[model samples]
Target chain A: MLKVRLIPVMTFNGVSLVKTKQFTNARTVGNPIQVARVYNSRNVDELVFVDIKATEQGRKINLPLVKKVIDECFMPVTIGGGIRTFEDINDLLGIGADKVLIKSKALQNPEFIVKAVEYFGSQCISIAVDVIVKDREYLIHQKNDEKVLMKTFIEKMHQCNVGEFVVNSVVCDGMMNGFDKILYQNVSQITTKPIVAVGGAGVPSHFTELVQTNYNGALAASSIYHFTQYTPQEVKKNIE
Target chain B: MIVVIDYGMGNLASVQKVIKSLKKEVKITCDKKEIQKASLIVLPGVGSFEQGMKNLNDLGLVDLLYQEVIQNKKPFLGICLGMQLIMEKGSEPNECNGLGWIKGRVVPIVNSRLPVPHLGWNNTYKHKEENQGDTLLNNFYFIHSFHVLPEEAVECTYVDYEFRMVASIEKENIFATQFHPEKSQNAGLLLLKNYIESYA
Candidate 1:
């Protein structure tokens, strides 16, 4: 049987690994390649690298950085952050990225998801839905004037034949309390797509609890090395 | 030299890197002449079956590869979509014909209630008769929605997941895996090493 995967997500700013608070106040942690090598040795299920500023800065994904990471690391790596067009995804996949995450652009043009799925099997594309609560309701109102309901966006993407989804909690992001269980459960209820619960993972039991709810994977950034002594191995053992 | 077929389908870099790490000479190219002179061939892919077949056909490699792998009996290995392309036909992206090297049809994995793609690492123990004290064909990284149902089930060496899906197939002079050995850490590297170092 395929076990539930425990993924360690490293946010990058150019070549340096950085930590952010609700997607702001970036602080350099270390070299991404170096950090990836460490995770590789740990035998984690997979890895995710998000170029936090790529979309906002209006640039493409860091290809060299992705190449360097996949060179040393021997697991499936998903690259995200500045994926805006089909060419960006093509270039990333050409360099050996196992999966590419699309966020802002998908929201602007939902049709891109359909096209991407048509070209590169649905398994290769993951949609990252950044969500925050507004007026006591969870909504996908990012920095732009455009907005869509979280529930509606998920249904639309699923209909578009999206392979998986990364339901990011903008309100709980970097807060380190725990995951937005409500959000994850709600999304999981709507679609059977692989839900990688990101943002606000503070401890091992947090992941343990998420797995009990049938969440496909748990993605941790700060909790792995910053706030806890638990390694991915330890977390897996805990759940077992 | 071992030639890794570059049909403009999947990432051939990691495949080349893994083979090189095993202290073996390897080359990545689409030229039919280079493929003709190679001692061994590795076909790696991770995209649509239709496109994968079209790329080989466009490069004029289908007939040449048939002569080399089937007629010449050169050791050939396919990975992921490459493995799927070995089947008689595939039902992905469209109903497309394959290289027909193996008697099988590639279809989506529907028996397992788990996610469609069946991503992540899983253990693949060899069948009882082929177990033969070799552990190289154990755990590997798999990422695909469709799997091959070969006419000769004995060709399959490993199966896992909820439905005992086909994981790795091996016949005389030909070996292919549904999982990516290059990305499968030590177990995968050892499998590649065994393929290159242990001649048949």
Candidate 2:
């Protein structure tokens, strides 16, 4: 049987590793290289690094920093944020990134996703969908403060033939409470493709809740890893 | 020296980095001379079967690989698409010919409730207990939509993903795995170390 993946998401502010609450109030946590080494030693299933401000800054993620981080990782690493073109993807993959996550560019131009999938294969391309809950309904949250219906956005990207969807809950990000189960359930209903639930994982029970929903993977940022005593292996044991 | 054949497929750095960490002299190149000098050849790739074959052909590596791996019997290791390419044929995107080193056909993983591209970590079991030292029965990272079905019985490791699928194959000097041992953390590193030491 395929084991459910436990992925640790490391969000960067271009220079340093940081944590965000509801996608705002960026707080510096630790050095990314050191953090990646820790994850490598812990033997986490996979690692994700995202440059949260790269797209808005109109530049690509810090390549040198990512290269150093990847050096410390033996596990598969996914690189994202400010990924706008074929060159960006090529550079990251060349530096040993196993997969590249596309968010803003995927929405701004769905054709880019199609072309990327066609050229790079779906296994290497993952689409990140950030969602915010409004009136008990999931809405797609854009960097520019504009919110679109989550269903419409998901349906549009579904046609692009990307490998998997990294569905993140902005409202539950860095909350240390629990994951948005309904949000994941809704997205799973929309598409049968693999869904990796991100944001709002705080405890072992939270992951157990996620597993009950039959999702493929769980991506946590501030779960027991940063804010508590439980190790990633411990959390994975609970899920099993 | 281990030459990681880089046919412009996908990331070869991870494979190179792992070999370097294992303290083995490794090079990533498409040069015929480098491959000929290599004590072992590692072919690592990620993409469609059609594109993979095209790149190998375009780079003019198909003939060199055949001479080095098949004719000369150089120790060879293939990962992911590298493993798939050893089959007689594949049907990813469309029907295509593979290297035909192994009697098999690569086809989409179907008839399962699980999602396609059987992604993430899964435990592998040895097809026969006697062939234990070569293949480890541990969890390894896997990410692919198509798997190779050997036409004849081969000494292989299998993983259960609602069905038994070939995880790795050990045929004489040729060793190939559908899982990314480089991306599988400690278990992966150990597997690579074992492979190199066995060949060494």
Q: Which predicted model would earn the best DockQ?
A: 2
lDDT score, residue A82, model 2? 93
Instruction: DockQ for every model, please.
Output: 0.66, 0.89
Error of 1 at B109 (Å): 1.8
TM-score of every prediction relative to native: 0.93, 0.96
lDDT of 2 by residue, A1-240 (tens): 777788899998877888888889998889999999999999998898899899888987889899999999998899999999999999999999988999988878889999998888788888888998888778888767676888988888788878778888888888978888888888988987778888887888989887787665555555458778888888888887
Candidate 2 clashes between residue pairs 3 or more apart in a chain or in different chains: none
Docking class of 1: medium
Best by lDDT: 2
Question: What TM-score does model 2 achieve against the real structure?
Answer: 0.96
Over 4 Å off, model 2 = B128-137
